[model samples]
Target: MFKMADNYSSSKENKEEIDKNLKGNEKKKFEINKYLPYILIILVLVVVIVLFANLSSELNGISNKLNSLSSAKPTTSVTPNSTTENSTILSDPSYNITGSLIVPPKSLPNDPVITANASFGSRLTNINQPLNKSELALFNNANDSYFEEAGQMILNGTFGGYVFGSTVGSNAEVKILDNPFVVNGKPSVIYFGSTTCIFCGENRWAMALALGKFGNFSELYKGYSSFGDHDIPTIYWAPAHYNQSAEDLGNFYSSKYINFISIEDDLPITGGFQLNPMSTIGARINATNNSVYINAFKFILQLNNFQGTPYTIWGKYNVLGADDADFGFKSEPSGNPSIEYKTHNMVFDNISHPNSEFGYLEYAGADLYIAMTCASINNTAPICSLPVIPKLESYEGYN
Candidate 1:
């Protein structure tokens, strides 16, 4: 009986201990459930804060990039085989000359208008005159060094700070055509400009430099743009009488590889604009007239792209306007030829060195023309093999 009571007491004690442990576990689980919503809420708030911070940082980074691009200068660099969007409109009124006589014809005339005088009545006062011998000597002697440096720059793919194929503000770039304008089984480079045009005055420097690479200028004459048109000092490829006559249709460039034909107006700016004369070659292009190099004039007039003075056709490529703007010397006071005269002399003196301001800018502009010429001629020139020439050609959409 004693043994049976002892066993009962022990069993009763074990059951009480088991019940206490179960109640403790139930109370702990209830406490955890009560705090579970608060824990989830805290975790969601933390995740939201982290996501907002990351989004804010990304937005700030994007904003900074936008600001940087908006404040940057106009770029004069281009990668090869890339097409840049041109923001400028071709028909912008700012590009139009107020009284330009070189207008697009309704139809190309079969023959040139034959005038008895060819001097455009009494408007033409002076005729072709040679430049001073002393002045000509300076340019002739400096040709060798200038050519060497210009070629070097083109080969290097950069001139001054500008890339070989890039263009500056509002300046027209070279456009490729389907066929080249050829003369006597040779490619022809034609230029039509006026002595009174300020852009023409500035562009001649670069044109002369680029042409020098392909040919030789046996004779160049001293000329001034016009008194009303800033009277910029310029060089004429042919003997020309400034502000006087346009009857002299002679050129001095001799190139066996390519023919250079220049048709320029001798008349300068009168009454703040050039005089209107229908008889001069600048005023009208006669298609069938072989005497005045009418083929080039007719080609330009037929194209809807022809705008104004300083027009050039480089092989199959056409540059409708000045390749570049004024090279810092164009700001001289009107009627003051001496300032521009000195500036031209300085450029001539430093033509061989790219360190000078005028020299660098002129050479950069020349490289652009040179690249266009190379593209048109199928890279026949020795300098065309340079890396920059191909890059420039590719950039301008050449084959």
Candidate 2:
């Protein structure tokens, strides 16, 4: 009986120790479960940070690519959808033929009529008008894709969308004849201006940019009007030959469909108020021959009593000054002042005047109107068939 009781006491003590060890294991398991949520949260945070870092790198790469595209000059070549293959009309034509006769207005019911004057305007001053090689390179390079697109926009008369300033004198009408001036069986243009004229200097920017569309220019010299004037940079046509071929053909001869009679008459006065006389070939053309320039000037004077300088005669239409339909950043009575030229030049005071404030794109539409109006007179040139011409023709200002 004593041996049985000792065995029972040992068994009871062993069972109690076993129950205590089981409770300690349960407490340890509960503590581990309490810390598990924190560990899981930290792991999720690390994964999100890694993903954001990858996305940020991709975005930085995309931003760099965009910046390069915006700053670099465009190198893509553009070709018109139209073709010149097997064309009856040559892409390049020599506009050399018999000159038109300019007749003086009849006085007192048909007085003795004079055909032409032989006196040429005298060159006012001996100002050097040559542009350096570096300057020319800068100008050519600047005429990149954006400049070309501006030209195209003007031709299409779609520049109104980009208008910026007051739209005054966009295209003021004087008078147009059903039959305009013709040369070599094509329409012609006559521009009479003076180098000393401030308005002419400002007008030349848009005029040069507009004319560049129809043909190329060669030996174009750069100069400013009289320093007393606004002193803006102008493409002095005294030496420029427009509508010429890229191969540097002879001056005063156009390879395009139309002809230009550009006359620059007077130079800025050096120390005096009186402008010096500048000799011009156009004056010679007017003196001894039947010239449209002489007739146009005389007719304009008769119509408006010496309206102003920088007069343009496109066929029968008489455009007195620079015209822009669109508004600019600054409103101008004559033109939109926000438009600028691509070519750069320096003023007399050593200040660099690179761009024009006039609306070039808007003025380009005016020039296109002149070209298309002339085309309507003699629709022989292939350029007349361009789709943009019709859209420009529909505008009200052209009539």
Candidate 3:
């Protein structure tokens, strides 16, 4: 009976120990359930904060991009080979404003019977006189040899020594057009200018020199630009009674390789620098005209807007303004009609001799114009074989 009581006491102690362990596990489970909702809320807040931060960064990036685009400068968009009908008009305000004028009133008669005169305080004695035998001989003597020498000098890279504040070849204002202006079964060179244009007065020297390389002017005349427009002593390929009539439009230039067409306003400078009305030829030529030369000129003007005087077309290239800026002339107290006349006389005398600075610049400018012509004519001329011609062709994007 003593042994049985000892065994019952040991069993009771074991059951009590088991009950205490179960109560401890139940308390732990209740504590975990009480804080479960708070833990889930913290996790959701962290996810939302992370997502909002990422969205705010993306929005800032987009806003910065938009601001940059809005502040950028606009660029001209042009297609290199676009057809004339579909080509974008590239209008530069600087070019358009250079000696350009609005179309004047049409009330002026087409063939006004106005007398030509040099009444604008010009000092030239022979303002609109035909070249005498001596002057003509001098020009003829200098033509061929000077052109050859200029081309060779350009080829030797020595031409730049005389040029100031400008470069030749690629720096020229010439633009390659989409199609060649052909007339009389040959490529055509056209000039549209005004007698009163100051730039035209300076540019005629280069034009005459370049054209002389290809052909001869039969009836060249000595002329002065408008008295009000600085009375620049110049030569006219046609009989342009400078400061007088506006009817003369034909060029007396003859070339076996190309056709030379000149359309100049024969009128002198009017009051307030107002431009004269268009000449009969300029106003009338259209699609109905049977003359291919006239029609081609009209078409090119339509293709490229007529910007200003001294506008020229050498085969396929268009020069919108004076190719070279005025370099060798003084414009202060020393600049006057008499001085300009003397300077022109000096250039004429030194064309073959080239002993003066003005003579050198004239030839250098002519060399650039010759290079442009060579590019237009596929470098077929004998002068185009010079080393500089090919370089110029590449610079002009011809090759």
Alpha-carbon local distance difference test for all models: 0.57, 0.44, 0.57
lDDT of 1: 0.57
CA shift of 120, model 2, Å: 32
Off by over 4 Å in 1: 1-172, 245-248, 269-288, 329-344
Model 1 C-alpha lDDT per residue in residues 213-316, reported as the tens digit of each score = 77766667555566566655567676554434453344677666677877776564342436335345644446424532654555564444555777887877
lDDT (C-alpha) at residue 18 in model 1: 89
TM-score comparison, 1 vs 2, better candidate? 1
Which prediction has more favorable lDDT, 1 or 2? 1
Between prediction 1 and prediction 3, the one with superior TM-score is 3
**lDDT ranking, high to low:** 3, 1, 2
Worst 10 residues of 1 by lDDT: 92-101
Q: What TM-score fits each model?
A: 0.56, 0.46, 0.60
